[model samples]
Target chain A: MSEEKKIIICRCNDVTLEEIEALIDQGITDIETIKRLLRIGMGPCQGRTCLPMVISIIARKTGKSPDEIKLPATRIPVRPVPAGVLVGEIDEE
Target chain B: MKNRAEVIVIGGGSTGTSIAYHLAKLGVDVVLVEKGYLGSGSTFRCATGIRQQFTDEANIKLMRYNVERWKKLSEELEYDVNFKQTGYLFLATTEEEVEAFKENIKLHNKFGVPTRLITPEEAKEIVPPLNADEFLAGQWNPTDGKANPFKTVFAFARKAKELGAEIYEYTEITGIIVENKEIKGVKTNRGTIKADVVVNAANAWAPILNEMAGLDREFIPIKPFKHQLVKTEPLKEGQIEPLVCPPAWNDSYVLQDGEDGGVLCGTGLEYGPTYDMTPTYEFLREVLKWATRIIPALKYAHIIRQWAGFYAKTPDSNPAIGKINYIDGFYIAAGFSGHGFMMAPGVGEAMAELIVKGKSHVPLDWEWYDPHRFERGELRSTAFQIG
Candidate 1:
């Protein structure tokens, strides 16, 4: 482990594997709490890229199965939408 | 889990965690229980702006102390809470708004808060892309700032735990045990925790617990109002440093968050005592409409996420922060309408002070925040509220 290079887990927020593992060791099991603390899942991708890996890591570390781990609720506008487009810009004649 | 503690704090949001931390710091044994993860409630969902520019002197004074506590919070917790005092700009678009802000500035100044009325040009300088034509004047208070909502609450919980406070997350309080009008303990899903003093710091969910503690319907008028916010994909930092609020336009506001440069904006408070956390399309569209109006350049910005949270409002938007008159060991530190995150540190300090030492050094009319104030028809308007 000491010889290994620092591994990044959440690419959008640049959160690391070590960081996630560290908080897990501190007895923080919930991904939601971890996400808030590190802002890992709150990026442009909205945890889509990082959550699976983080969950697996959490499950492996905490001795909980993947099924037992709580998943964050996938919020709306699943794909990113431009702010201007949402502002009734598309005129309805 | 400890079966007995001197104090039991329900809810683990900003206020609850801070109250627990402050209590523990004062040598009181505190146990904090949360139904979900800490700060996952309104604390995480609310907009990230702490301001002292209020129309009411009491609120202005309370917020002044809250800002001071937030400044020291990072150092005090030995954790970087990312507290930055970028200041908050409340814009005045109409003559009535300008006149109202002028009065608010005077009141703010009286409390040693250096809030000043600035020209629209100065406001545009602060938030460069600000629609200069809309506002005639702005109230800028340099000390009003924001800290990381998540970090702030978690730091408090961590420090409180370090100080021998027991923090139980995922432990839902099933019932409150009261014997002879005194709080005996709380019944949680896990088990019973015997605490003499029970604090209903549960925010929007506080009324339920108040009812469990035998509070009559009349006493438990605390309701939740739905408020919504949207965050754009990381925009450039420094473009919008201050929280630019236009009270004239449905209390709409926009500010760039420091965490990832996402421009967070709000359409303002909704009027229902709503429990629904569903992010509405109408809310998103309205926020986009008003936020772009505030800064025309933001039209191109991409929205990454939208969320809804409750205000857990009282008869007044202000919170009930002291001991309940009827119940012996029952206290309240919740119901901060929309300003709970900003007010948590001060609430914690004041609530702890009230419990341990019988008084708080922080200057506020204590009776104003009392839980029983509603009975006397003493509901005062929340400062700087547009509607």
Candidate 2:
């Protein structure tokens, strides 16, 4: 309920625009590097909403084509799963 | 006697503006109208991938001609469309797909498209990061390319306007005035304009527009199918190069805007029939999952945004590109499904030729793409990956 507009650049990891900008300012402008450093678009939602916005900002500042940007890796089941299921303990013999 | 045109082309996408330009170039008085902003509909929604690899002779011919035009689009239109010849890699991951690609390549080579059947190693050389563990081969057409859909549409509209053609924005065509099997004019939300010819170039809403003319519902079976695209932040210098189209793993395609360096990616999801424009969470999930699995390097590529657009499906995947059956001066340029952008330049010119000179010089068998082909049980399965 925070009235602040959370610039959720990565719906998967709930990364914010401010965080991405800070990383870019720190000379970590590469999308892959940023993902490795901050785990931004690595979550289940992937970089769906945030990918283009970040690309636009970078392109505006650096004058690059969105095509030059490397596409994010796709995972299986492409959808999200329940945390309970992910953490379920298996029977030990 | 005032503020009238001989032909009023509806919809402001590439098809409409291009038709208007060709007509005006042929000294035909033309007026182009749009309900929304120009290039905002399917044109902007397009991934802008253009290629010349099809399973048919006529389509290959049309796309080949379009590629020729795209080469000099900037010079002809006097504006830069940002046309990039980064080549297209249609990856095949199965034996069946490889068999299909053989036929496609045969047709392409027959029509001088220069598509070659390459081994997975060749595809890996081009893409480098492709998951080549399981795939037969792919069709690589180096002359195939991508472009800026928005800029191209704007360039067409600007050129059309310069040639004594009137373009009205924010104007909606509510009804078409047809009497005695002839088009009289169109009734817009603003006012009525009389015209001798009315071309329905509205992409997704083409069926509804045809209904407005009181045409038969079976005149064109154009249905809407939604697809999603996502983009990532700019990559480091040499991670990936050029646009990628994988026919094996999924119905997914990838392209990077050279100007922005952001990776624009899309996939034809298994979406059933629906006109809703809402971007679903499911779409995001599937697109990202495939992007990661196919190119493992994109595992961390931050997704910037996602969007959805509709494809107007015809009984055949090819569009209904000519005149309506009995309605004089009522033509159709819709039902491109998802491949409209690639064919826009050539289609516009062909439609213009049909409108002005009664025939097109592109040498396409007009009978196959005709709107009347459906009723004659001459249905064509030209489109296979219709997501």
Measured against the true structure, the TM-scores of the candidates, in listed sequence, are 0.96, 0.79
Give per-residue CA lDDT, model 2, range B53-84, as digits (tens): 77777777888898998999989999888887
Task: Residues A1-93, candidate 2: write the lDDT tens digits.
Answer: 333436677765567767777767765566654564455554445656667777876666567887887665543324433212222221222
Q: Model 2, residue B120: displacement in angstroms?
A: 2.4
- Residue-wise C-alpha lDDT for candidate 1, range B1-387, written one tens digit per residue: 899999999999998999999999999999999998898778998787888877787888888888888888899999988989999888887889888888888888898899999998888788888898988999898787777888888899999989999999989999999999889999999999997899999989998898899888568577988888888888789988888888778888888887888998987757577788888888888888899999998888778888888888887778888898788889988888788888888888888998888898977568777778888888878645421
Q: What's the TM-score, to 2 decimals, of chain B in model 2?
A: 0.95
Q: What's the lDDT for residue B239 in model 2?
A: 39
Each candidate's fnat: 0.84, 0.00
Residue B10 local lDDT, model 2: 90
iRMS value of model 2? 11.7
Tens digit of per-residue lDDT, candidate 1, span A1-93: 853426888888888888888898898878888988888778889888899999999889888899987788777778788777777664222
Candidate 1 accuracy as lDDT: 0.85
Docking class of 1: medium
